[model samples]
Structures are given as structure tokens and as C-alpha cells.
Target: MTPEFGSRRTAIVTGGAKRIGACFVRALAEDGWTLLIHCRESVAEAEAIAAEIGNGARVVAADLATVDGPDRVIAALEGMPPPALLVNSASLFELDSHDDFTAEAWDAHMNANARGPALLSRGFARAVPAGQGALIVNLLDAKLAQPNPDFYSYTISKMAFAGVSELMARVLAPQGIRVNAIAPSVTMVSGPQSRENFAKVHAMNALHRGVDVDDLVRALRFLVASPAITGQTIAVDGGQRFLSLPRDVQFMES
Candidate 1:
């Protein structure tokens, strides 16, 4: 007999419709997880992925930048079984040179990237059953370390959330819920602007190469599966952190 959605081991993956999030959804699905994929403007893409996965896959639409978005997602998953995993993979990334930054920009970046994940993490902690091995994986960026002069707000928000990974892990670990974060360097598979951003990143890395999105998804999979690890920021960058590359290299290359 097929299990009901409530009966299956499930995960709520925010922004699981496309790109790295979609890759994460595919990985979790292969692990036999029922997916509640939360997407903002990517409803059609989310639905398409749900259909492809075809077993206990559901799509939720919400602008996580708002105050109520996290609650709405939790409501959808509440009917499911007690043991649930929450992947806080949704984030807003923008690059405004320091001089171009505005109050609206600061709030917008904080809301979507930092506040939303914190809200979701709190909700998941309360919702998932005790001793059921629940996990929350926050998708962070290596930009937190490098400090993008143009993308300060976005990077700062991510750094804040990255710090929370340890705080939540310490408290939640006793409850059988593990909280960890992944800080990826620029990935090869985003958009045109992102590609350009990554080109700069590739040159910055010690290896002078870009990283595959698949490698990041794999790290996420390991984080979700390993109960022994928690409160860690796993860098998926290809040794980029060690190298102190100059920012002027980007301007010169351009």
C-alpha cells in the first residue's frame, strides 16, 4: 500500500523550484522524501518539478520576504507527519555598490535573506517531532567572507544567518534536529549576471576555477543525512577562501 503524504518522511524545501534549489529537490526525492517545494514567483516551474517527481510532491507559493510567508509554509506542512526536514534555500541576492545602497534596499535584503530563514528555522524547530532526526539546512554564500563592496546588505544578511546556524544547532541538537549551513562560492549555473559574478569568483579562487552546482547539492545531501554533524558552516568553494585575491583583478580583466 502506498503511504499517505502524512505518513512518509518529508521535507519542506523553500525555493526548491529551480537552479540549486531544484537540484536539492531532485536529490531529496531520490532519497524517497516527500517534498513540499516552496517557491515565490516560480509557481509554474515548481509545479513542473512536482509533477516530474510525482510522489508526494507539492508546490507552495509565497513571498518569503513578507512576515507571514514562513507561517504559511509551515501550515501546509503541519498536516504531514511529525518528523519533517526544512531546507531554507530561498534568498534574495542583489548587488548595489555601497554608494547606491538605500534604506529600502537594506530592509528588502534583510527580510528575504536573513529574517525569513530565521523565522523558518524557528518554525521548524517547533513543528518537527522530538527525536525524529529533523534537519534545517540554510544555503549561505561565500560572499559573507569576501565582502562584496557592491552587495554589502545581501552579504551581511547571509553572514547573520550563517552565525545562527551554530546557535540553532547548539540548542536544537538535543531535540534530535540538526541545523547546519552551506556557504558556496559562485556557482556555474545561475544567470548571465551571476555567470559574470562567478567568472570573477573563479579567478579569485586558489584553484582559479568555478564550482559545479551538483557539488553543492551533494554537500547538502550529506548534511541532511549525517546526524553526527551540526552547527557547522561547510564551504563548498574550491579552496577559494584561502586565497587573498585582489578585487582589482576583476576591473583589470573587464
Candidate 2:
């Protein structure tokens, strides 16, 4: 028989302090999922979320950019039941042009966006019972296919993480653990965004609409509830993936 919502089931949401991560935390909490919200520097924000969620959530701070960051997060959950859900929402987004790229910048993106998710998923899989099932939802970017030159390192790292989602799903399926990803396009905001800026971004998509935090939350819920889907990425970008880019100047001129 399936267990109750808040019975023994737990979810670990990395970077669950602010922005998209915090949205996931609140949504899961409302669904009666006990959450371990991990944050790197948003301790006060994390605390606020924990308090807001009351009994359904708690917080843990870990720097996912370091080698031991994932370990520290997993260690914090030692006494609880193995989390049935792992949301790798914690990531680093930085701008790096190819001409000015540095190893340090590349490494930072790889460590946080790619390596951190891979390691956290690994740890969560190990903690689950041999025959029991688990789910991992990785956060990805909508431009994963159309690589943005402006955010060079960030784009590359997210691409690597998308590959990790597929690889993990294939390897862990036999154990009943499913892995999937959600590629959202400008769903959450870090600061005040003017209507003009919003309209400009919205105009780039096929739907002529911008994604909101609720859209991402719905995608997460669908992935968690669907038992047959695995190793796939759902682009919740209002059909932006289908949009085509203009040809180069020479081609256009021809």
C-alpha cells in the first residue's frame, strides 16, 4: 500500500531558500511533503520559510559549490527516513563570454550546476531502500538546446546536468528511482522587473507569455505523480523550444 502524504515521505530541495527553490519548498509543503530545504547563504530566508511552513519543512545550509557540499546536506538528513524526492534546484548562473572565460568561472558553474546535482542525486539514491522508489527533478534552462553565448559557462554546465538526469534515470530505474528535469524560461524573479522587461522576454516565446512560479510547481507535481515517465525533460517554456532563430547575415542576404 502507498504511504500517506506526510507519513514517512520526505523531500530534499537544494537551494530552497529563495526564488524558484523557495517556491518549490512552499508548494511541496502544502502537499504535505516534509521538506529539508538546503541553502548556501540564505540562512535567514530559509529560516523564514521553515517557520512559514510550520511542521512540514525544515532548513539546512550547505555550499553546493564545494566538494563536500552535497555530503554535508546528506549528512544533515542522517536521522530521518530516506527522502523519496530530491529536487536539484540549487545552481549557479553567471555570465562568461568565450573571449573572457576563465577556468575559475567554468569550474564554479560545473561544481554548482552540474556536479552538485549529480552528487546529491547519488546520495539520495544510496539512502533509499533497495526495493523502494524515489524521484529526482533537476532544474534546467530553456535555452539548453540553443546555447546562449552570453552565459557561456552557465549554459554548458546546465547542459551537462541535463545529461546527468538522463544517465541517472537509466542507471537507477531498476531500483525504482526515476529521474527527470524541468526546463523553465524566466519563471521566477530575483528583483523588481519592469513591465517592459517582462514584455520583452515574453515576446520571445511562441506563446507570447512568460512562465510563472506556479507553472513550474505544476510541472514538478506532474513529474512526481507520473510513474511511467523517466529520464525526460519537460520544457515549461510556453513552446519556446519550437521557436527558430534567424539565419546569419550572409545566409539572410542570400
* CA-lDDT, candidates in order: 0.77, 0.81
Residue-by-residue lDDT tens digits, candidate 2, 69-132: 8888888786665578999998887666788989999999999999988988898888877776
Clashing pairs in 2: none
Per-residue error for 148 in candidate 1, Å, reads: 3.5
Q: What is the C-alpha RMSD of each candidate to the true structure, in Å?
A: 3.6, 4.2
Best TM-score goes to which candidate? 2
List the pairs of residues colliding in candidate 1: none
lDDT of 2 at 138: 95
Per-residue lDDT of 1-254 in model 1, one digit per residue for the tens?
A: 01222346778899899888898898888877888999999999999999999776888898888999988888878565454678888888766657788899889988998888888889878887654667888889875665546466776778788877778988887787788888887674342354565465455567766778788978987876676878888888777767644442233243
